[model samples]
Target: MSLRHTLLAAVAAVAMTGLAASAQAKTEITWWHAMGGELGKKVEEIAANFNKSQDQYELKAIYKGNYTETMTAAIAAFRAGQQPDIVQVFEVGTATMMAAKGAVYPVYKLMNDSGLKWDPNAFLPAVVGYYTDTDGNMLSMPFNSSTPVLYYNKDAFEKAGLDPNSPPKTWQELAADSKKIIDSGAATCGFTTGWQSWVQIENFSAWHNIPIGTKSNGFGGLDTQLTINSPLDVRHIGDMAAWQKDGIFKYGGRRSDSAPLFYSGECAMYMNSSGSYAGVKGNAKFAFGVGMLPYYDDVKGAPQNSIIGGATLWVLQGHDKAEYKGVAAFFNYLSSPEVQADWHQFSGYLPITQAAYELTKKQGFYEKNPGTDVAVKQITLNKPTENSKGLRFGNFVQIRDIINEELENIWAGKKSAKQGLDDAVKRGNELLRQFEADNS
Candidate 1:
């Protein structure tokens, strides 16, 4: 009960306090995402799973507006030395992200640094090729890759006297069916598209195996030209223009803004990302179906694989070694088959790994869900052609804006599709050249 006992009690209390702090403290990793609504919820759910599964690290996801805003924030934050550990950048931002070599830690390098065994073959070639360097090293992890596909209202098709179970596989068939839907008054608009630049222009070239640009669509190098003015591209746009005149096709909005029209049953057919399934399933009042993106029946090698349009997770450079391990651990968790399969099922994004696809198949997810496998089949049905590999051009965000402006003029009858596209190519090419010069 003297000085010795008092000193011993104080030391024991201090030891207990240290143990408690060590037990409760957890390393936190910040993830900046562009998802909102249901997609945002799914991202949080995945993060929660990772947090619950391990005590070593905790992932914190922050939605940083849409794709453009997210990319801009990441760049600004990196400059300010306040960037999150992970940033979600869209497919269009691939060139921009790759060009920022000083700001990024290549996903392949991160995986290897963490000693995580990652197999490139586990991803769909078309999906992985978009985010990889020429040597096929992954620059980012494909988080929510999706390609354009057809969405149709079955009830509208039946009312239009077309086969509800069958969707048009060729551009000609789509036109004819769209006309029928319009004539039958099945829907206010026969066909509408979300992300006209992404689906019709960018993926149109890929699906028909026509080049969207030269220099390997910018994957080979940065000095790429806007070739959407090609004969085939012109022909396709011209047809769409003629259809717009006939009321067979309606221009929804610039980028994925037409989704609501389709979901509202105002449009009989819609063309958009496979990822749109989540929105459609949530909002569509009528029965719906999904099909492969249509191509020109007469085009040689038509119906090629479509390129991805979703975002990927890129690890920013300059973080400490401990933080890099946390990033790698989170990536590994996200890439696991169970996590990937659940994410694919919940969000309609295609699973990025082969193991995830196999796990989904084993779980009978496809059989029970019916349309869930459409993305996998569409992406893997054919090996990616030169055009189908993916587009990788500089200043693509501005280029897309230019394309939207030109396409809007065409839809408003201010210009012919051929005239509009030709002008888009000319102007877009000038911008591309300028970007090339500046970046190079």
Candidate 2:
């Protein structure tokens, strides 16, 4: 071969070798998440943006199914020593994640160790409080936090002769309005709900200054018992059961299966995660307004702040040291005001950082969007009391299922509200006891 051709081939070979080495040197960070549909696409976009912003790392977000399935997959993968660097766990799975000591790298320590300028106080209390240890140390990074809000059809309200701009603020007013809506045939049913256990029981107890369990709703310790059968709880559940018979309240199904009922104009109002804002905006055919979750005015301090739903980002163990720094960088990027505000504006999630919230307002998002701020206002309406803070019982995921089943039984006439709730408490306490023993 000629000397010129040989040198050219050598140069090409050297260049190819350099490219392969650079690719190998890039740190790949894996994040397993539960975000699905358009939300999942947004997750990918965020990851892609992060990848483009930095050359040292590449992030890959994989959908691991629903919240429960994502958590389960993470746990199983951890046991197999193959867990991702990060996982998205629902608020209900907080206890499970906390119990997996040595498996999780607490966000506080992660940030501090990485020498990042992280201020714990920068996060909104109502959202971050759920994933903090008793010492007030944050265990996970708050992401996609949301609370229940009242979503009403404005067109239906006007037809029913109710103020379209005003939604019911109290339980008594809600019932009266629901009757009016049904009687006037503005909608087939007055209202339906999503997340029956979450909205009906968990937030219900919190909003009314009642506890779902003792020991500060399991924040105090693992030894906690369900107080879900309280007098007020029974009364509320019984009222819902009665309303079901009169078409005032419809139990369309569980875990947001009923959301279509509201979006399709089958029901006039819905109580669901504020995260549903984006979905409702796209799907609903008529004008809708967001309102705070209704409270019973008769109860003193009844309108206590509501607790949050949605999930947090947990940094899992078993990744390389280089990857840890990448994880920290990714988290910092995710928490930046610009990124967070954009996410909140697009997805209807509560921006975890106070700075993000302020940035969003400064951007005139709430002013232009109207009811988009209802979740933030409702959850931050008052300082969270012990009852209003949040729940953290171990085995709560399963307990939530038991609560749902009992509620279904009550709605189906197999048992009264009081009896079904009583049974739920009894059955849930057994699981709590088991969790306590295992975690203790």
Candidate 3:
């Protein structure tokens, strides 16, 4: 009842309120990603949702250009000790990311350190395997994973006197159908592709169960050699060259440069990443259908699983424990079924979890969008063989550039498929050896 005692209690209550507010303040973590357009919006939305959910941390998503540019920037930032808490690296950069000593904080380690009980089994095997180390520990979290698929203009197929409902299931069928489309004037070109090496060499070898390189595609050992220039690979490229001459297949530049051809209605058939679905849906004017990528159909174990093409989230090493905790929490939020399903349905990326796939299936998202599951079915219909799992090699970005050069020579009729690929393998092996020595 004394005025002095009452004043002291009031002041203590006000100070306690201030302390509680300060304790619940969020820790900020930066995430540098390569996503743009609608995908970028989804990333920001996820961050916003997580920031509102628990108030323990806030994830800041920053656009850092495309895959190669993002990786380059990350490396530069790392050298300067200014790297973000997390960086999205493409599948091709897996080896480079792993080889960088003390540059990355493994996802498993971060989760464990933060007391987050993470389950590796929750992710699709083919996806998780790409980011996991030789010891089967996950080095990064798989997000926005995708695989190549066939997209055809149904109107073009009908005009060519082919069954609009049925798509080419084999390479022979696709070639034959493409010819008809061109001959019938259904499109300016029958078929065109983005990233010739990615669709033709990388996923092509995996889908056909052919080795891209020795030693389990370089994951088994550090001293693996380039073996992608095999007889089967040469034969496939030779067939494509012949098709090019016959005006059935058109060659575009690397990556998704050919996407404009398909979107502009110049190409009747396209083989590109499933992640392009969102863009195609917005741009295509005619009725379109999606199908699984065509394979040889006769190769033993043909129709094997296709590897992913998108990127994953890797935590950088120099960040403090508080930042790492925020990174782990953000990853956990991103991996939930609701988030995964919404993303898969929105952007055509494969749902990284069985629960997300099931959620989409139950909600009839696939039924409403008939071809939405084509990528999922193509990647999961068959178990992954050694060849189908994924690729890991140092200086792979340079290796991809070499592949582009050789394939371009073949397309331009300057070299035969066998010769071009042989030269690429030779040049690529030198880089591989150098990388082995440097990282050893």
Candidate 4:
């Protein structure tokens, strides 16, 4: 009732009004990504930069474990009606996301609906084609596209009397070089690889220009069947099994567990995603060289282009128009030549747009970084055929698990290469069929 009390109440009301106005000024866009460690920092930096570059939106980046975990979390959130504005899904989960109908906003359509000028043609064909629907519409924004590349320890190569400048181009050469490195006191083992399903099976088939399954590796339609039990595949698996016995190849682990074998210098070489450049550059104590994935010398159309494995940004549904606009603006910012080039240079991910690649080259990034261009060159080495462009199998995460288990069986001498591969194909096909039934 007093004059001083009235003034105090008015001041408190003004303060609350200011707080509400400040919160309403910028729409917050939450992004869920799977980039961890140094890569996670890069994602956060990008979000901060975007937030600072605009007054209309606050881009909040969140790390949600690995690729599989991130995707699983996103889907679960969607089911619970608490999905983030954007989610990063790995290339392997492409089919599952595509099948989710109303859950995704379709990046191309989102950009159009938001009235943001978008040219899908500006992106690299390999990157764009992978995320595009059969109708040629872009499903997700290609954020961190990467392909497999061979990394070898230069010091180990030199100690083993192998040419440090020259990396093995053929499987035969790789086998011989691996033996020389192992037989000598250079390394405990010749080589190890991460993502047995990806590096050993999927990319193996692509680099050799062979199909892992019918219907163009599941790119054509849902009606597909695994053909990983082919003669070439059997021979390659059999060779790896023999190499394991000879101590030329070691099953370091799954996914990226084999990375330490190469980084610790226990293994002379490693085959993994090119996005791992930042990690290897950070961890390896010895000088290293990058090369294309090795292929069998006798196989026709061998050494074809390697496919990508990194994640892409999908625009999730259920956001308001203001939020969608923010997402579009953030996507555009992320796709800019400067942003893309910086990400490609710093994180070793491929620049989704051609302009970014050109900008990187003009900046002499490739020359300064040396073997960094190996992935770009290998990805665009030749025009992509159905078998080499990329794969689009359903339930591929489960398929990859099946493949890893089958591969381990062969490597551990529990099953012959043919038997292991046959069993994998049989088991994987069941999942594929189930996926078709569920999606259809």
Separate clash counts for every candidate: 1, 0, 0, 0
What CA RMSD would candidate 2 show?
A: 4.5
Best by lDDT: 2
| TM-score, structure 1 vs. true | 0.92
Top candidate on TM-score is 3
Better of 1 and 3 by TM-score: 3
Give one digit per residue, the lDDT tens place, for model 3 in 1-440.
Answer: 89999999999999999999888887889999998877889889988898888777888889999888998999999999999999999988999899886999999989999998788788888878888877888888998889999999999999999999999999999999988888899987878888777889999999999999999899987799888789889999999999999878888678888888888888898999998887788899999999988889778888898888889998899878888888888888899999999988988899999899999999999989989899998889787878988889889989999999999999999999999999999999999999999999
lDDT at residue 14 of model 2 (Cα atoms) = 100
TM-score of each: 0.92, 0.93, 0.94, 0.92
- Answer with 2 or 4, whichever has the higher TM-score: 2
Per-residue lDDT, model 4, residue 118, is 80
lDDT per residue for candidate 4 within 1-440, as digits (tens), equals 99999999999999999998987788989999999988899899999999999888999999999998999899999999999999999999999998889999999999999998888889888777778776778999999989889999999999999999999999899999998988888998988999888888888998889998898888788999999999999999999999998888999899898898998999999999998887898899999999999999899988778888888999889989999999999999999999999999998989899899999999999989989999999888887778877889999988988999999888888999999999999999999999999988
Residue pairs of candidate 4 with colliding backbone atoms: none
User: In candidate 1, how many Å is residue 18 off?
Assistant: 8.9
Evaluation by TM-score, superior candidate among 2 and 3: 3
What residue runs in model 2 are displaced by over 4 Å at the alpha carbon? 1-24
Residue-level lDDT tens digits of model 1 in 148-197: 88999999999999999999999899989988888899987878998999
lDDT of 3 at 169: 95
Task: List the candidates ranked by TM-score, beginning with the highest.
Answer: 3, 2, 1, 4
Provide the lowest-lDDT 10-residue window in model 1. Answer: 116-125
Candidate 2's TM-score: 0.93
- Candidate 1 residues lying further than 4 Å off, grouped into runs, are 1-25
